[model samples]
Target: MDRWTWPAWVGVFGGLLVFAGLFLPAVVWQSRRYGRLSARRLLGTAALAVYGVALIAYTLLPLPSGDLAQWCAEHGVGGVQLHPLQFIADIRRDTAGLGLRSTLTSVAVLQVVFNVLLFLPWGIFARGFAGWGVLRSTVTAALASLLIEVTQFTGIFGLIGCSYRLGDVDDLLTNTLGGLLGALVAPLVLRWMPRPAELVQDRGRARPVTALRRWLGMLVDVVAVSVLGAGLGIGWTLVGYALGDRTASAPEVLTGLLPVALVLWLPLLIGSGASLGQRAMWLEPRWSTGEGLARGNLPRRIIRGLCGAGGWGVLTLIHGAGPALAAFVLITALAVPFTRGRRGPSCALTGAELVDARAVSPAVPRAAASTDR
Candidate 1:
């Protein structure tokens, strides 16, 4: 129970860390590929992360430590059980002259069951979540089982210098069988999961801009600016150390200037005039009444930038302005839901509308038709 419980807890902790790290990237990918996020798919992704960590924890955890020779002699499990279906004979011998319940409860029988159940999720995930065929899932499961067996036999590729667990051929066979069974039942188990093809079918079509989408995009921009600032600070400190200037510190101006460039200058000069976060969320700014973001539209672009994430970035650099920045962010977030097209503070202020980047402009079709004539 301790062994199982410990690994389960470890899996939960590690899984959450994995989920947190992948959350933003996964959201970005889904928004781009599916034109909208699916809560069900996101939940599935989270489950996958937990399962992945649990797999590692159960297989290779509680590593051998301290007084290697003594531990190996007294407690270590070594050598290979190469005979196929050996567990059947072992179970039968142990259960001789015993009742049905006793046989079922015996260690030999239970071990085989545990091994089988361990690989079951692999087939389910491969077939249902990953959309793999039955044969492929089964074969892959077999390969994974084989790898685990080899690793155990070689004592984690000679890391511990001796095997700490038996490499059993019976375990491999049972594990593969479990995976095959799982694959066969995957459809029934995962009936609610959306097909990848269906999700991407209308990916190029426009989606309505929502407050949640706006908030997520803003979050991405904030995170990007923070990451960029941290990275630049680190680089500056490293360069200073390399130059033997122990007292050298990052310049206040460069940190502020670079973030402004990232959120403001670069987007204005580049395609679609969307911040990095907005682009990731498949959103862009468009003039509400007339021309798109063109070279001659410098003033509008500047106004939009100053009112959006770029402005936030600049404000963050000012000393003793934390409260003001917080207020600005809070007000903008609150304003999003009330604004037309769910526009953020920037769009509302500049008379620009937020739209899905994939949405085709109304004038594009007419211009193309004219060219054909």
Candidate 2:
């Protein structure tokens, strides 16, 4: 549309970044709890967010133009079709012949078609992700359509002085029909893909530690640490200014260490045993056999942090690490993929192993274990 311009592109880019910022944590959480992250699941998550955003853009965009006061005075917003058959009649009127142009090229017909197609995803997702059937999907589609109409009627929550878009009954009818169609077609696609119920069932299955999961956890942990560092950097600047030193160097080195203490060390000391990333990815450090959830004590956490990536390794940027620090980082990073069970070098020294935190299996009697031994 003519409305999509440089500013629209910028808004889209910013929206995507914001969506990713929020969605990544949820993906990590789902992966942690579900014990697996499939390509399908990742795409599904992205598609859901994109679809919702697209609807908002399509329905509430090209915002009211010209002077608000003048536009409100003219007031071209309040319009609706309470007649359910009005759109169908309009489509019939748009057609001039039985040819392809008459059937598909009419702008009125296309607009009506788009309105119906817009909610197709609602049906697909309702069945594929949430396992909704025809009745539920219909209800959901009706409610969502109502919301869109209400948003149009309300002039985007009253930011605009008056409504600039029309609320239509035909849209409600077509969208609901489209949703019902989508729900009916869902089983066909679902027959070829993972069922929603199966995915839910997989949530309870025990999963072992893996290199990929550990890496994901660490990646999230890196972001968590950087955020902490930035916050600390800001605080340090404030303190410097308060002391009448406007040009004082910020405590950037100390900034990185606080995250190591809070996200890594503090949890071990408190018996949670998982960093922010570890919690997100469902990884936990074990201390010993039969000690289940072996979150280390304070000394162990401090020792591990200094020796591994979570500890002093993060200070490489601010403190400028020597060859020893470089080697430690390289070795620890390499050991994760090469070592059996992908154990971190820090784990070797700390006498702990990172395991799947939420993993579980049917428990046999203690006497059964003795008998097997």
Candidate 3:
């Protein structure tokens, strides 16, 4: 291969690795979580599709090859046949056999630095979407690079047609290391963008509510919580069964346990959502003078949600009907005060003192509101 060709292949491989690292998981997770799709995601998918097409074109298309002598003969532009083995040979020659001293030199350091910088965006986007801490981000990055290397070595044969691509394991190591470094830097980068994570304190005078309105809101909250908990519990049980025995039918289990699962999730979901969802929906949970909705940080929300779901799991194990059902009802009833008053349990847990949004000038831009929330 010509000098230019070798570098071009490297560039292509690196670009594809980075693109896959950033976009593939984004597509899967976002779709699962929100159900609602965005134009940006659509465009991203389109771009990836185009890249796939280009890879096919590059692999199947003919290209000019041979020395200047053959070209000058005017018989025809000498065409060189693409071969996978030749590409692999070239890659090995270029990257293999470095002395320890050379490996530790400035050039190697720079290479490592460049690799880390290349995947910084991947780490940032992964952390933003997954809410996965550093460990998960690093593991994900490593797996992405491994997939790319495997694809290259296999000549994209699994899906796309065979191509003249040389896969190197070193590439995976370097790429993953890069992503890990990037993950370390993501927090610092996000910190500089303060408006993206500003906490909104919802404190104000309690609005008067009719008895009917209060009753309806309570019903809605309880129903929503129960349904979510039950679904999650039954879903988890099915997963556990599937993992334990391949012949186990997940749908059958889900069908049988759903009612109990709903019973389990109801109190937790309503308890947690009453305060947080109300805030998100532009409503407040207020009582006598104590002030705003409880802070209900991410950890608290996750715990409450999981606890509600777990309540159903406990019911499943104990095989009791009356007590389990009663406990769920009791929990839901307890959450009502938190949903209603300023000093409710949720508020006490979160330390959120509400303030009037109207009184505070809007410092956050509408464009950045989603991130802020």
Pairs of residues clashing in candidate 2: 287-294, 305-311
* Candidate 2 lDDT score relative to the true structure: 0.68
Q: Is candidate 2 or candidate 3 better by lDDT?
A: 2
As a TM-score, model 1 comes out at 0.84
* Residues 1-373, model 1: lDDT tens digits: 6875777777788998999989988898898888789888888888888878887788777778987777778877756899998888899899999999998989888888877888888888888888899999999999999998888777789887778888889989999998998899989988798867788897876667888898999888887777777788888999999999888888876666786677656887776778888888887776633433322267887788889887887788789999999998999889988987788789888877677766635423322222211
lDDT of 2 by residue, 1-373 (tens): 3543434454466557656876667667567555567667666666666666766677677677778878877875665667877977887777856677767868788888877887887887788766777899879998999988877877876878667788888888888888887788877755544655667677745466767776777777677777787888888889999999999766645676666666655655554556676677666555654623345667777677666655643554554567756676567667788765565777777876666655421222223222111
lDDT of 3 by residue, 1-373 (tens): 6532444354456546656555434433332333222345444444444444333333223332455244335433223334423434544455568665554454445444554554555565455433467788888888776666565544344433332344545555666776677677766754433221221121222233322232333344444455555676667677778688545444534543454445443334453333322322233321122332233445555454444434434554454576866776566446644553332233344443222222222232332222212
Model 2 ranges off by over 4 Å:
1-19, 71-75, 96-104, 226-261, 288-296, 309-332, 358-373
Query: Where does candidate 1 stray beyond 4 Å?
Result: 66-76, 228-260, 263-265, 289-296, 362-373
Scored against the true structure, residue 150 in model 3 reaches a CA lDDT of 61
TM-score of the candidate numbered 3? 0.30
- Identify the superior model by TM-score, candidate 1 or candidate 2: 1
Q: Each candidate: what lDDT?
A: 0.80, 0.68, 0.44
Candidate 1, clashing residue pairs? none
